[model samples]
Target chain A: MNAIIQTNELTKTVKGKTIVKNVNLIVKKGEIYGLLGPNGAGKTTIMKMLTGLIIPTSGEIMLFGKKLAETSKEGLKRVGSIIEYPIFYDHLTAMENLRIHCEYLGFYDKRAMIQALDMVQLKGIGDKKVKDFSLGMKQRLGIARAAITKPELIVLDEPTNGLDPIGIKDMRDLIRTLNKEYGITFLLSSHILGEIEQVADRIGVIRNGQLADEVSLSDIRRQRTDYIELLTSNVQRSAFLLEHELQVSNLKIVKDNRIRIYDAGISAGQISKLLISQDIEIEEIQKHTSTLEDYFYHQIQGGDKVD
Target chain B: MIKLIELEWRKLDRKKVFGEVIIYWVILMFLPVFFLKVVFADNPAVHFGESYGAAIDLMLPIQMGFLLFGASLINHVFIEEYKNKTMALSFGYPLSRKRLVMVKVLFIALAVFFCSLISFVLAGITTYGLDQALEVIDGSPSAADLMTYVVRMIIHSFATALASLIPLFLFGIWKRAVIPTVVCAIFLMQFPNFLGLLRITLNPDLFYAILSFLGVASVYLSVKLVNRLGDL
Candidate 1:
């Protein structure tokens, strides 16, 4: 598959402080690419640079295989974006706002506008002024304007921000439908792990203005580790007993008097019984299955390179 | 470019712009007669009451009020967009920021020029009509007086349109200060009067030409430096 978006050493500096450092990212066409990072991690800044809202200090963005810059922005016509939040001429009605957007893009289709509003579930509110809209409604309206062009790519920054559960679900579904049905690629940024986990085909972990790693969701799932964890003050004796008696040799001790047993054929019940019979005090014990949350946590906290 | 200028107009609040234009028209239309009948009635140094030709002199300076109208547009088209982040939307478009700023400047200049020209005609008609009924000034308007008014109306309207943009670069786009933009307009409108009050003897044409040049320079700088100054 061809790359829809590529950034080479993308960096942005403001007021002599580096906001986004040397970062390289690639987003393939026809896939939902998620940028997972904490707040102020330069996700919006990167999106802004890609969308031509701001110029980068050092780096180049290739959109649709063309250089994205202050002057060479023809590729932006095929991209729709809402960097931080939805912005509109609050005094204008929703229809007027969308109309202005289409006119700028030189794309005019009244029926398509209606369909976009319908897709975002903002059909009947087209005639209403944007100032009267709730935050959720405004977000939906922003989505409507973005998808109204049916561009090749849509970049949404925290698309679920200020949305109810149903609205968030609707947004997620809308993104999926647009991707699946229309083949519109997406670059979505969010701090919520579950939100991205549900929608993103691939996730890029950004930490402190750096691209830590980019991996497919399936790859993370395949590498999911299942382990048995126990907290005991008498760590050395438990380690000895578990290895000598239970033949559990694949165990490792962690901080805070805790041990993680990765040995197969081991159960929390059997481990608890063994520890109790041995007169060893067990503070806590549980069988664990690592999730995307754990993967994301490790990626962010440890900045480890995952294969 | 015209399409982009039209888009700028579409982005604005039409009703509010219409209301503002109407207020400017009505006040400017009556200001010439108001000064002649009330403010300058007893003053001897002010000779706007001597004849229709003299009243044209007073009317020309009075029409500088359109500079304030230009300032208002700079607020609507430029400063307000910057404040509300709609400018970010425009930046996201395929067009460059320099082109966008150029279109906005052209829109403001064209709107101010036409509106000022219309205000001059309305003020001329209203002053003449009121003079016929109230006998505010000394003789009737001559063919020469009418000819001069028609020519100066066009020239001064164009000058006022450009002069109104004097603060656009510094106050409107750079500082994004609304109060300073309006204050700058007020100062530009009263600039000739300030020279008179200070006993300056500079020619009127020279002074207006200078103001108009400053407006053009401001516009040129705005378009040239927008890429750096236009960041949100």
Candidate 2:
């Protein structure tokens, strides 16, 4: 599988302050890739660079195996995007906005325009002026415009923004349907974890404008850590007995009196037997599995390499 | 390039722009006749000379009115797009910023040029028609008068186009200030009047040449440094 988009040591600086720095990224063809970060974490900045909205101060962008730069914009014709927010000619109707967008791309498809609007559930409102549109409608219209041409790749920055819960779900389903049915690739950016979690095939965590890690959902699931939690009144003695007697070193003390054993190589029953042999009272003992959210938290907190 | 400019036209408020152009034509079309027949009827030979050719010279100054329209276009094409962030959408297209800026400048230039030419024709007809009724001048317009009108029409059309682009670099792209852009156009249109008010004796042709150069420089800088100026 070829990578649809790749950035090598990409850096963007504005007015002597680095906004995004030394970032490397890969978005494979026919996959839904999500950029997960907190607000003001440079997610939009990186998206802007990818979509050629702003020039990168350093490094390079390669789209479809070709260099993307001032002289090399041919690849962008096959790319579609909405960065920051949906902008439109407020006085123009939805159909007019989409028509102008298509004309710029040298594309003309009235039926496809209608279909795209229909796909986003904005079918009957094509004749309505954009000035009267609600925020969610504008977002949906933005998606309709981005997907209207059926470009090879679409980059959406916070596509679910300003949307109701139902609208967010519809957006997620639309992304999935486009990816699965039309085989379109996506590069989505959002601060909402659950929103990305539901749609992204692969996740890239960003922290402080750096690519913290990138992992496929399957990879994370395969490496899911299941730990046994032991809560006791006397954690000091309980930890001592587990370490000295049971030899449990793959464990973390989460709270004052709780020990989480990550090394599942030893059965929970064996640990219980050894801890019970000691005189420490076992207040609670339960098995806990590390979720994707936990793995993401660990990756960000630990600053681990992207798997 | 034509396609890109057409796309730019589709992006604007066409009704408002059309309304503005109509208003400019109606007002400028009658301005020269009003000044020649009504205001200076008593001293027509002194101010407007013997032939209606002098009425055309007044049309030249009145044609500078389109500079304001050019500034308004700068507001619509450059400043409004930036304020609305639709410019970012254009940047994302498979077109370079230099090309995009070029298209925008040329669009405004062409619009101003076309409107100025139309204004020239309207002012000429209005002045010629009104001169018959009012008898403001002593003699009929000669072949030389018609020739001068034709030559000035082309030159002033080009002048209007260039003058419209004068605010592109400074006020349109850099500061993105709407009022400053309009003020710049007003200053360019009234430059000769300002010099006259001060009793300055410089040649009007020399002043127009200087202003034309300024307009060219503004356009050059706008295209050359578009990468820096077009940044959000």
Q: Can you list each candidate's DockQ?
A: 0.76, 0.66
What TM-score, computed on C-alpha atoms, does each candidate reach? Answer: 0.94, 0.91
Candidate 1 lDDT for residue B161: 85
lDDT tens per residue, model 2, B1-232: 8888898898999999999999999999888877776776677345674667666667788889999999999999999999888888888888888899999998999999998899889878887787788776658888998998989898988877897888999999999999999998999888888888898877767767777888999999999888876573
Interface RMSD of 1: 1.1
Second chain alone, TM-score for each candidate: 0.97, 0.95
lDDT of 1 by residue, A33-69 (tens): 9999999888998889889998999988999999998
Clashes of 1: 0
Between which residue pairs do clashes occur in model 1? none
Q: In candidate 2, what are the lDDT values of residues A1-307, reduced to their tens digit? A: 6999999999998898888888999999999999988888899999999888989999899999999998678898898888888999899999999999998888999999999999999989999999999999999999999999999999999999999999988999999999999999999998777788788999888887888888898787787778899988787777777787778788888899889988767777887787777766788899887677776676667656433
DockQ-derived CAPRI band for the predicted complex in model 1: medium
Each model's C-alpha lDDT?
Answer: 0.92, 0.87
Give me the candidate number with maximum DockQ.
1
